[model samples]
Target: MNITSFLIYCIIITFTPGPTNIAILSTVHNFGAKKAMEYTYGATIAFGLLLVISTLLNTILMTIIPKILIVMQIIGSFYMFYLAYQIYKMDTSKPTVNQSGTFKSGFLMQFLNPKVVLFTMTVIPSFIMPHYIAMPTVTLSVIAITLIGFLAFITWVLFGTIFKEFLQKHKKAVNVMMALFLAYAAIEIWM
Candidate 1:
């Protein structure tokens, strides 16, 4: 595999603002660093599992990916739109009492996030499958991707912690901006 290109792609996908990253940011801003780390750990584990599942199912997916790609994209777009709306409607008046930063919440969020799903599905096929067909190579790639995802989660949480006061002061603006980004991601998925 083109390791450099693969790394670049992984970095871009994992580091970019997405539902998981946004959740981590919001969690840190509201709950505290400890809670945010719990969330991050949960998300990281889920992401790793997803990567493994995607790798294991690669052969089956390759056969059907073309046929289901459009459908998956549509589903992913709508899901993103929903998330955008939720972010826009987020209540900033009080720190969320909704357990938004819990480990379970983080796990479920990553599990259901279409952005992660699509990233896993495409990355394996496009980057790893073509060149690194060996089982050991695939396993290593999955591990690398998972670690990158963990780092991304940690980075976002740290950013949120650093800017927690600012986020509190400008909660509305932050929510709106994040909502808009998610909306754009939805549109991009469709395109």
Candidate 2:
């Protein structure tokens, strides 16, 4: 495996704005850093689990993925559209004082996110599997990927936190932008 290429791929996919990152940013913008961290931790745990599962099931996935790829993409696209609608409809009249980010929310978001699933499926099988067949190497790669994912989550949270004031001041604009981005992502997945 070309480690450099693999790493670059991982960085690009993990760092790009997706459901998880968008959620994190929104959470921080509305609820603050502490709440966002909870979501981040939950997402990180989910990401790690997904990485391990993807690595362990590489062979099985190879056999079944071709059959399910279209279905998964369709489901993912619809889900993204739903999320976009929700974001667009967010009530930004006031800060959600009671809306502390929950671990379950973060965990479920990543667990159900098709983008993350696709990322794990493709990256592991194509990059790690081809180059490192050893269990140890695979494990290390999973750990590395999980850590990188966690960092990506943190980056988004930090961004949101830093701009919390600005976001709150222009809540409608921010929400609309995020909603549009999510919609675009959904359409892209289908295409």
Candidate 3:
């Protein structure tokens, strides 16, 4: 694996504005950094697990990915739509109406998110597997990749935290914009 290329790919894909990051941002904006951290923990665990799964089942995934992708696409898109609805109606003034920012939600979101699913499936094969076949090396790579993903998740939370005041000032607009971003993510999965 070309280290630079792999790092670049991981950073771009993980740090990009996708459903998970947007969800984290919305969670931080509405709730707080603590709630967002809870969500981030779940997301990070799921991300690492997905990477491990991809490593263990790389060939099987390659054969079945098209079919799996289709199923995940439908499921993920619907979930995004649901999240969009939740965010749109989110009122920070009211107590937590739903548990969208909970650890469970974050964990499950990774499984249902097509972008995450695809990245986890592809990253191992594309970057780690080719260069290193040793178990230790592969495991380390998985850990490193997972760390990269965790950083990305945390960055979104920090971004929301740093701008929480401004976001809250225009809560309605921010929520609508975040909601629209998620809905757009849902729609983009098909295209």
Candidate 4:
């Protein structure tokens, strides 16, 4: 495997704005850095779990992947729309950490996020399976990828923390913008 290319793909995919990242940013903007961190931890755990699942399931019948992808895409898209609606209506005036920023929410979101779902499904097969067939090597690869994902989540949290004041100043506008981004991502999965 081209380590450079693999790393690039992992970083770019995890770091990019998507449903989970936007939610994390919105969580920080509204609730606080602590809430966002909690969400990040959940997301990171789910991410690693997904990687492991993909690795184990890679040997299954390739013919069923298309069907599985379709189901995931539909579920993920609907979930994104639901999240977008939640963000759009967020009352930033009364700031309170709720279920939205909880670890469980973040963990569940990963399973319903198409960007994350697709990334986990493809990354293992493309990068690790191609070069490293040993179980230990594959386990290490998953850990490294999970770490990269955690770093990406932390970066988003820090960004929200750093710009918390500015983001809160225009909280309503920011939420709407983030909502639209999530909606756009949901639509983009098909094309």
State TM-scores per candidate.
0.85, 0.93, 0.96, 0.96
Best by lDDT: 3
Please write out the lDDT profile of model 3 over residues 127-185, one tens digit for every residue: 88887899999999999999999999999999999999999899999999999999999
TM-score of structure candidate 2 = 0.93
- Clashes, model 2: 0
Candidate with more favorable, higher lDDT: 1 or 2: 2
Better of 2 and 4 by lDDT: 4
User: What 10-residue stretch in candidate 1 is worst by lDDT?
Assistant: 92-101
Candidate 2: residue 53 lDDT (0-100): 88
Give the poorly placed runs of model 4, Cα more than 4 Å off. Answer: none
Cα lDDT, all candidates: 0.83, 0.85, 0.93, 0.91
TM-score of candidate 4 to 2 decimals: 0.96
Per-residue error for 135 in candidate 2, Å, reads 1.5
Model 2: which ten-residue window has the lowest total lDDT? 93-102
Residue-wise C-alpha lDDT for candidate 4, range 44-137, written one tens digit per residue: 9999999999899887935688898899899999988898998898777885656668999999999999888889989999988989999999
Give residue 78's error in model 1 in angstroms: 3.5
> What tens-digit string does per-residue lDDT give for candidate 2 at 31-145?
7888999989999999999898888887887888876677777777787788789779888885566354778888877766878988988888888887789999988889999
lDDT score, candidate 4, position 167:
91
Rate residue 49 of model 3 by lDDT. Answer: 98
- Assess candidate 4 and give its lDDT: 0.91
| Comparing 3 and 4 on lDDT, the stronger one | 3
- How does model 2 fare in lDDT? 0.85
